[model samples]
Target: MLNRLFLPSIFALLIYGFWVSAEFKVIAAGVAVFLMGMVYLEKGFKLYTGGLLENILKKTTSTLFKSVSFGLATTSLLQSSSLVSVIVISFLSAGLIGLETAVGIIFGANLGSTAGAWLLAVFGLKIDLSSYAMPMLVFGLLLNTRAAKPLKGMGYILIGVAFLFLGIHYMKEGFDKFQSSIDLSAFHIDGIYGILVYTFLGAAATVIMQSTNALMVLVFSALAVGQLDYVNSLAIVIGSNIGTTVTTVIGAIGANAQGKRLAAAHLLFNVVTAIVGVVALNPLMVTVDEIATLFGIHPHDYTLKLAIFHSLFNIIGIALFIPFIKLLVKWLKSLFNDSYSKEPLNLAKIDESSMERAIYLNPAVLSYPDAAMRALTKESGRLYRNTLELICYGIYFSGEQLRNTDNLSELAENWEKEEQPWSIKGLYIRHIKGIYADIIHFAGALEGNLPRQQAQELFALKVACRNFVQAIKHVKHIYKNMGKYIESENDEIRHQYNQLRLCLASVLKLVDILGVRRNYNHIQEHAAQLKLELHEQDQQTYSTLNKLIRSEQVDSYMASSLLNDSAHVHDACTNLIDGAVIMITRDREEYREYDLAGFTPAAQKTSS
Candidate 1:
């Protein structure tokens, strides 16, 4: 288990070592020092989930501006865009903030990343910080051995700082050997091709290393040796911005609709920023050079220029795009639809009537919410299969017969009408709700240092399950009443049944999101829509109850029961939407007022 868990971290370390060079080493060491300082400044994210930070931000002139600033600070310290993105996603899921607010925070993360580049530039220039790095490492290890609280924190900080510098030292050693032997200056470049090649290389390196800081070091190495110039490196930094999105894109693979949508949005933000950098490169470079000259520095090294251009271009990109954020949201919605298929259709399989024999069907019992979500996700997928089979078998209740009809409508109808064993459905529904609660529990068990959005998604899953239960009950009730007075020729039994079915199906679709897809937005919207449908059905139920009572068709006791069930369904749907909304909303006050905190499940009773 330890090996499995640490494998990724080991890979990250190996990659860092492989790609880092001597010029880059100075940059890396500086980044480590700065990161240590940031950890001290924030006191190691004491009130994480961004509450304290969010509060500080809200007091600023603009909430959006504040969020961006916070995002930058947080990401700079964390050094992992994936970690930051997960936090943003979690915040949206937890109902601590809105999607727009989260988006702004993410934008800030891009800017915050320039901190790494600046650190690299600073260290590259100083070239003497290495002497103290070893001392810091030795003292840090000693302090860590003691149990004193403050010393321990400082010790951990020192250790991180030491490793970072050590990594940089090794990296610089690697670069030094190449600089002495290699003659990059002899291989001069034509202007356009030079810029394009180096720029593309920067982007490629960032994508491969998954760190802009690491990529900046590579550029610094080239600058340290008179190989690549500043303007070209800046171009590469610009391209790195675009390339960073590839990780988020890969993370979204096989995710539900919402995850894919957010991934696309992240890609758009980076690519658009890259374009902005391209357009303003010459102007930005001149401005930086003018400043460097004022400070009596030649700015001969293009590495600093790359850093300057990176910060300016990102700021400019944010300035140009911030106001039109809503437009971007709208564009994202238009570009991707829920029905958009990400996977190829599986055609070669068992016959339709042998669905139970299909690999998709299994007898495994679900013990956790994740397990239940997995189960329900598989079950929900049958909706499409069932519908297609119905069409293929000519199973419509209408009089008209199609040219391709083999009169399989009877077969389809029987299959549809066959009452799914109550125990089976009950176990499934129980698992659904169980898994929902488990998700929340698992999130809560996690270290609180995690972002707020992460916690709220777990809660949202719980809400979604509650809503699913109501939908299932409503459908079962309708099925029970179908052959009675509710099913008369003139009655709208079929319509009511259809409403229940749609709500239930929607709930099932949502289960896929919670299962493993991690698409919070897609599940959230669908949850809200399902609730609205359930609400409408409640009204219809009331209307039906009044008519039944007027004609004495349904006795008082039966009418009362039906009304209760209808109301329960309505409430269930409302709860699901509320839970999802809390997951998505930015305003903590809104969720607090709803008191969803009351909805949390009790800890599982352990066996004696």
Candidate 2:
């Protein structure tokens, strides 16, 4: 059993068992089971946060209203607002939108999400589209086998559209039959508790369905068929808001601090809004009723009014909270803060929470690397400052902080055990891997829409950063393993470390060129000169390895490992600068520079 197949089989079997136990009809049970499966699938799809945002932007580029329609339609087609919200959240986290701008988009997303509801309300109640679903699915299956790109895309669209209508049809039929036989006519309950129960139901449904759109459609169909009322529907809507957070929460679980933050923000927004909604239920519901009546609509007209209310609540919430975003953010920080954590967090990860936090940080940094670098420098400084504070606590206030001499002894033992040279070596290995990956990504991005000169400059900076990662790691390694390693015998390690520092210095000089705007010629000249210097340094580092090893003062493994690490660092730096050169020299018809001698043939390939 393949890993993916095993879970779906188990889920199907479990759902079959549940449907039989729940006394649900076969069709209703099938729909319920499929929805359960959909939730898991949508959650998996949400991992590509960046690509999702790009698609959202692509769909929304024409006009704001059209964009909203496109968003709604696309989400309806996809059957996942959590997916759409995820894209929106990523854009927000990436600083693609300001707080005020994001407020509207978030509102738009809420509106767009209602498309599925409208579809279900109209089609589920008035028409039977389930008959076409099988044909559409079959057609899609055929199209998927075609070699053409357009055919494949159409195939996907057909399949998605078919599944969506099929799901709606199944849900409607289930509820209609369930309603006719089982009397769920009315239950007199307290307003707040009723709202809470309905909201919880909505949340649970959305979570199980893995889609707010699905729940919205269910609510719409249920109301259209008169199985549920406005108050109950409204409560479910609020619950759907809470349940939607589950996708992002799951997305951020193993992700970095930034991812966690975005997920947290999403959870916070839904939970807070739901709570406030519960508190304001009576007045808000009345207001909705009054507004609907004023528009010459019946109080019982659930579809139009439901959509209106969903839009209204989110819009009002966004408006009311926009000005107090900073305060809300501060509150979130206080709420989430833990005194024991050592790692710093990226607030952008709380992307789904609000635009204020998500839409202003990452894009700013990625768009303007200089600004990002400055910000990173400041952050690095802060990290070091915190480290210094900890060091002070260990030094001056050691006795007081430790509480007892035995405790101090325990702390020392723990430090010796936990912070060993092996751990430092592991960090070094991880950093080296990251440097290579970053360089490759930088090269690929340079080959795209960026101007030749700009590409080169970026390439130079990437090279410098790679060198910096190596040099910093070497410093950590030396500081940790200094007592054990023989400096006289380990001259190879010392010389390699020195060469690494020199490479860093060259990178710093090249980075200076990248700090401000410059034309292609200037960027090219700087990159070429820097590459030459780096090549020379690489040669020097490699040349000294034999001399240092012949002395036999240190073990061969350590000496050879140090040399190999140096070579890796050298390659990373050289590749970065070379990538810049390719970007800069690419546009020229007959360029004079081709410094391919330093690179291995495998590494010489560039996009341009």
Candidate 3:
């Protein structure tokens, strides 16, 4: 409802301002062009995100100080704290960094953003940058026409910088011209009430612009032209700092609970900083004056003074929060628990309609490659677990029975006495199909910004999910005759069906063990053993079937069913083992090293 009215109202205001004064029109145009530059700048930086940024974050965010330094460096380089915030949120959602580390990064980003104010105050206001804008735009346009993505990204950045300079020029000239017609200084108020009012106005401007850096540029330009008072500018700076968290809050809307907690931390940091700045305004201003004098800045240079205050207040906020990082993390965790922490695998209360929703895929993580890949891999694991459960139920066994590490033959024999039956088709639709579809859809939707190796990992996980579902489908084919044969009057056929049950159950148990194993060498050795055992079981079943048929222990009807079911069992076992290998093996290179070790004839014969 607000959006419907707000947009038209802004348009109407723009139309009226343009009709009222040419200077007002120029200022508005300057603001628009500046905003466009900000958009392009963010776009250019985003092109470099997936791998390089992810690696930097992983290497640098190990300690709180390092996280803060990384955040400061990144925000200073990008000139977009909002982008940094979104990246941090994505990292937290992806489990790339802890909440405490994320909070530290947010703290550092606030201090880093003050550099924008310093740059604008010291250089932007003093130089005639518009003189260089035309050449930059020309070069940027030529570079944009190139086919390479990095070159195109560089072009956008150049164009963005040019537009920003041009906008600053226009805004400065427009404000200077407008000053002759009306005195903005006459409207300026003094004291605490004035600070409160101007701070609120500053926050409103930032919320409307959605970029505090842009707001700072505008404020500096206006201050240079003697249109804004230093005291009110400082108040607006405080408000803008608090308002900057809106971007993170918006980004966190689709994020997991951890992302939301990081957003909350961002808001808390900014709000606390604003409150501190407001409460200690007098003492801070005095210190800023002293610092300005010590640094050889003129008292009349309000733009530089504002920059000093911006940095000083943000540094104070960081200092205040650094000691309480653990407490803040504890509070955030207490406020927001993991969304998927509930009973994810409760079979008794399965909601058929809820299968379409993703269990691990969060759109917020897509901005960071590491986070996005982790989400895909985790969701694939969930799908694999669900497939295992469905396969167990299809074979007239409970998931519990499949997971049990007790004597497999005794468990299978005991489960055979139970008459429980389930619909494989129904379970597939309710449990497997929807999750499989979601996993494929989610994996396909990943941004093309991932590193080649990570992209391959994502593809491998998708293939693993496909193999898991296919294995379950194979079990469904055998399920039709499984219960019938296991209870048949012929002891030979019944025993063979029981053997098939035990063989598949053993494969399931081995896969579960593989899931928990951490050592790369142990995983490889165990996975090879599992492959050899399955192959041996397949050969033993085939030999037993052939012997029973030759001895006339099994008639043609029984032989045909057993033969077809034996093939289905082999396919199911092979698919399950392949999928489990992909899921458990973290390093493809290690798996490659050990893959051929298990296929040797000597090892195979010894296992058999």
Instruction: Please tell me which predicted candidate would have the highest TM-score against the true structure.
Output: 3
88-185: candidate 1 lDDT, tens digit per residue: 54333333345566677778888988887788777843475457678987887887777655676677666666655555554555555656655555
Poorest stretch of ten by lDDT in candidate 3:
595-604
Evaluate all candidate structures by whole-model CA lDDT and list the values in order.
Answer: 0.53, 0.52, 0.80
For model 2, the stretches where C-alpha displacement exceeds 4 angstroms are 1-23, 26-52, 55-79, 88-108, 131-135, 186-190, 294-299, 333-507, 515-525, 530-576, 579-608
lDDT of 2 at 457: 39
lDDT of 2: 0.52
Question: Candidate 1: RMSD over Cα atoms?
Answer: 13.1
How big is the RMSD of model 3? 5.0
Angstrom error of the Cα, residue 542, model 1: value is: 28
lDDT of model number 3: 0.80
Distance from true location, Cα of 280 in model 3, Å: 2.4
Across 415-512, the per-residue lDDT of candidate 2 in tens digits comes to: 32122222334433432343344344534543453334444434443443444444444444334333233233455564454445345434433432
lDDT of 3 by residue, 508-561 (tens): 877877787644457656667776777787788789888999999999888888
Stretches > 4 Å off in candidate 1: 1-62, 93-95, 139-156, 254-258, 294-296, 338-608
Task: State which candidate has the highest lDDT.
Answer: 3
* Residues forming the 10-long window of minimal summed lDDT in candidate 2: 350-359
Which residue pairs clash within candidate 3? Answer: none
The candidates, ranked best first by lDDT, are: 3, 1, 2
